[model samples]
Target: MPTSSSSPPTDSPTTGGHRFHALRVVIPALIILVWLAGAGIGGPYFGKVSEVSSNDSTAFLPTSAEATTVQNRLPDFLGEDAIPAIVLITSQQKLDSADLADIRTLAQDLAGLPEVAGAVSPPIPSEDGLAVQIFVPLDADSEVDAAVEALRAELAATLPGGLTSYVTGPAGFAGDLVEAFGGIDGLLLLVAVIAVFLILVVVYRSPLLPIIVLVTSTFALCVALLTVWWLAKAGIVLLSGQTQGILFILVIGAATDYALLYVSRYRETLRDHDTRWAATKAAWRGSIAAITASGGTVIAGLLCLLLSDLQSNRSLGPIASIGIVFAMASALTLLPSLLMAFGRSAFWPRRPQPIGDDVDPQVAHLPARGVWARLPRYVARHARPIWIVVTLALLAGTLGLTQLEAKGVPQSDLVLGSSEARDGQAALGQHFPGGSGSPAYVIADEGELQDVTDALLGTEGVASVAVTAADSPSGTAPVTADGVQPIGPPGTPAPDPTVDDGDVLLQATLAYPADSAAAEDVIRQLRSDLGDRAAIGGPTATDLDSNNASIRDRTLIIPIVLLVILVILMLLLRAVVAPVLLIGTVVLSFAATLGISALVFDHVFDLPGADPAVPLFGFVFLVALGIDYNIFLMTRVREEALHHGAREGMNRGLAITGGVITSAGLVLAATFAALAVIPIMFLLQLAFIVAFGVLIDTLLVRSVLVPALGHELGRHLWWPSRRIAAASDPAPAAVRADTADR
Candidate 1:
């Protein structure tokens, strides 16, 4: 007769079912809000300012002894945004007095632009033989492209029929990018559609599947791009044309992959249970391990870019990481909900396989059974030998990784041309007696600057020397019989100007190609020989500086990422032994990936070594993805052990989860392979490395190596876990019972 008389029924739905029902609505709504905020609010947050500099002169001045010290440490110093733009000057005819007037007028107009640091045009011929050169300075903050466009517009408006004028340099390159955007975007879009269509069709074997994937992918990608654009506006990241060109394809490719993995599983489970809620739960349970693992891998790889020497590379990591994470969440939340909503119809008109045909009854009551059910039992039967063979093979492949070198040609090898920059490079070589890819300035200012100039001029690799700070080029404009006569050729034999009296800018033209081995060697020698005279400055030196800086970044980042993943896995497993084995296997997968990549690049792709950054990139991807497989397999193994014992648990874990992880790996690998078809060499290498790594991680490491190790370890795999240790007796019984059901 107490208060218990009015108690409600003891049994309602399980707490888990209620929680799942609530999350099915709430979590998705929250995810949608996050998605919108990231896409809509984050898009314009980056690139709000072109450069950050103060009006204070000393703020721009180099005052600290640490300034020079830091400058010497890498390719260039931080806070030194002194990348000078070149305007390659060309003439259709000799400089007549009329043409000279037009050129000077245009130069003066260009000089007025905010970003024109300086421009110099060689003096008009003093004699009939004197050569002509022009140079102009531009605003420090404004990009070269805008200045070039303004000047081009001016030239079109004012230049008379007597001559033609054009500007090509960094500004010119920027100008060209703006002009070429339409064409590039069209090409990229075409490529993305074709690639996405092909990949989805191959994986799903249904036209509807591909269409569904594309629509969902496009929605997610638009959101990611919008987010990136907003982030750029916020000053959080920089969005360049290169970033834009790659974003759509990358997002589509990555998100479709995650969706494909999750949705495919949901379809299989739906066919089995014929209940949307049960299928959703089963697919989520089956795929959570794989999704978490692979997503972690991608995130780790992208984060590795943060250690890059190039500001562009560093910025890209966080930006790409955001998209990857968003895609992952969409796969986990949005995708699962969509699968629930679609019910059995998603696989329709293509009839789902009958439950009896696909289901293995022997293992159904045992809580784990499926093709994967047989794997652990087989591995345990021959665990010792299988482990020995895999370990030996992986160790043997590890040797090839040592031969992998990081070296490559300059980026000019990658940039497109008929591009004015490319044309200018070629024309400069033809017109200027010797090649002038870009001139490097070696200015030494220990006060006795004249001696430093002489020292540099005396160096063996030095081609020609000029001191521009003194005696700015001055000559009488050409004269005609009445008002003007035509001038000589653009770079004809010209009168030499005398050096300035005091401070001088030593412009040293090197005798080797800017990107050549010889040029790098000369740069190194100059640094060694120029002890106290002055410091070397120029594009070649800058190239070398950036290369070394990148190496430093790689050295720091790779180990740090590996360590981070190791710690993450250890925490997840709550066991030191599990993390250690997992890391070891991942390392082996990476080695195999690198060894195979070296073979492909050396023999298949055929370039000098791989890209300079490939090792860093490959390390990032391989370790990240490799750990993903480990996570999936281990999580299931732990789940199985909790209910069944160690041996049966290992078998059941593989049976239940193996197909899911393998499918995820295949889809992710396929997406990365899409990058290979890109014409760019760096992207191609990245594609091959990632695609191949995922394949190895899935087939060899996850399928064979992990199972072999798990079988060999038995209960010891989860050592120090009293729960696991206590439940060891029934593992073989569970394995046998699960197998009998099949």
Candidate 2:
């Protein structure tokens, strides 16, 4: 083993390295100026928005005869286009005449609203009926959003007696989601600033340095967020609300980290010389490789999201990758200039040390020599058993994934408790033999055809069906020059007119509510039952399809990302054997994170298993961040190997880098812990899982197992690299020269 000889840099205090620091500040100021100018000018665009416009008359026409023409010929058509927005009925008992009058008034108000296309009341039994179903057809321009708001406002108004009304639907859900995210922007701004401020204060131990680091990091974060938004607006990327939250956390946390890693090292070098220029150079030289490697691995990991089929996950990958890239650039360029401007005063109250530089009291007693020097030997003896146990436990818990049911959570689950809408659903379900909310189909065909209606009435899931006169809203007669009109009008035995080229229309309603298990099952059966006779179209059908697609994408994408990371790590480490073990350990750490998250949500938090998307996101983030620790530890291991033989190098490397890596891991974990404070459960799960993954990665994978294996493998660890035998082969000037003769 080797020992210190290069003066430990900190043993001799000096004032130097200020020139490079000054340049760092000036360059960043200029860059900020450029960014501000670009922002003011509306940034850049690949193409104008006007390029995507359409001029076809049929595109916007609500009553396209061609659409109706095709609809009549289809085996099924669930007039999803004209489907009424769902409405809830609320009352404590069967609605009295007065209750009915208020409801009618409310319904009339909705009908008269500019956006409402039509309205209807579903026939509901009066026996023990506290609720009734009201259907409102959103006007052609209204869509889901307008209907939810209009109905919500109407419900909020004081009603007759003690009755209460609430609305829930696609529109209502959109409103709720918007409300949930109301103050998130402000909260994120406050949290990020505070977090960066606190971290800088602790690391630099100076008020001004913290402020500087905070400002630079915050600027970098702002640029990243604006970039994400620009990309989203330009259609180069897609980001949901959750993705926005992730972008906020990752940008600030990572940017701050880069600044800390560089600045802290810069401060350490300041103690060695009086010249700021030399100190800056030394810090840059010593820190650049570590920063590059750490940031590179993180960016690489995040980029793995590009392989994902999920648009959300895919978008996160590049956004995070871009953030880390900017952070690295700022650390190397912007941070140095800022440091030179501040000089030794950046340390604030802490006086210049004669023998030590910028040392934190928290790690003042951390081992620098002796029995602790043989940290790798300790790791070697215990690594296998500990690794094995943890691996088995994680693998065992992964079995739960097999049991993971992948389906989209209904909009109902988006709200808390049995909300007014849910109670309304319960009421509707009770009063109606079959839930009144069942999706209805409008089958259209050319020529009057009573036979189509007869066929639908005979179908298995079909309840009582109703159809209205097929008249064009524009007052174009339903009959064209060829005398065409749609199939039947309920009890009317009119001959079905040709929707277009030998087709007719028939309406069918299911015997179950849209959200019920029976409804979904009935839809499947209806599809099979109708065969090629109809085309299904409804929100329920669309929701089911989208849910399945999301599940399928998540199922396939996560494992592919892990496999890619394994291969990348293999090439980076230049060890086929080590990569496999490394991947296994990472997998264990990830599973442990999930298991703990499960425990928290299921037992501690006393909530149900997390929403479906939570697990997928947790998996991606844990794996990506977990690899950061491995890269940190492994890079140090490789550096030490080039200096001391494999055995001594492993121990010395662990001893030297362990504390810093642990500190970083804790800081990163705490950053994730901030997510737990968010109000949403999905974010809470993300926080716990990521925090747990980092802890396991730091303690189990990097600290104990990697060093243990390094010792166990010895020179074989660096196979094919003949330079492995060279005792100062790739010596890092500061640490290696000191430990060279150990």
Write model 2 residue lDDT over 1-742, tens digit each, in one string: 0012234323222444777556645665686566455434432321221122111111221222322333333333223243355566666766777777777676666667665654444323245757655666554343344456666776677456676665654444444544444334667557656765776567556778777676666566666666666676677866555666676677666666666666656665665555555677777887777677667767776776676544556667887787787667667766776776566767778734323444543233235565455555455555556556656766766654544433554555544433545555555555663535444444544333344455555666666555433343211113222333443355634433325344444445566665555666655665665555655544445444444544665687677777777777777777666667677778777766676566556656766444556767777777767776777667656766776666666666677567656666766676777775545556667778787788878776788766666655666767666655555433223333444444
My TM-score estimates for the predictions, one after another, are 0.73, 0.76
So what's the TM-score on candidate 1? 0.73
User: RMSD of candidate 1 to the true fold?
Assistant: 8.6
Which model scores highest in lDDT? Answer: 1
Task: Please provide, for model 1 over 206-239, each residue's C-alpha lDDT reduced to its tens digit, 9 standing for 90 to 100.
Answer: 7666666665565576667666766776767765
lDDT of model 1 at position 511: 71
Misplaced by over 4 Å in model 2 are: 1-25, 32-84, 112-129, 137-150, 192-206, 271-274, 285-310, 350-406, 416-420, 432-513, 516-518, 530-533, 606-612, 676-679, 726-742
> Distance (Å) between predicted and true CA of 205, model 2?
4.3
What would you estimate as the lDDT of candidate 1?
0.59
Clashes of each: 61, 60
- Give the alpha-carbon lDDT of every model: 0.59, 0.58
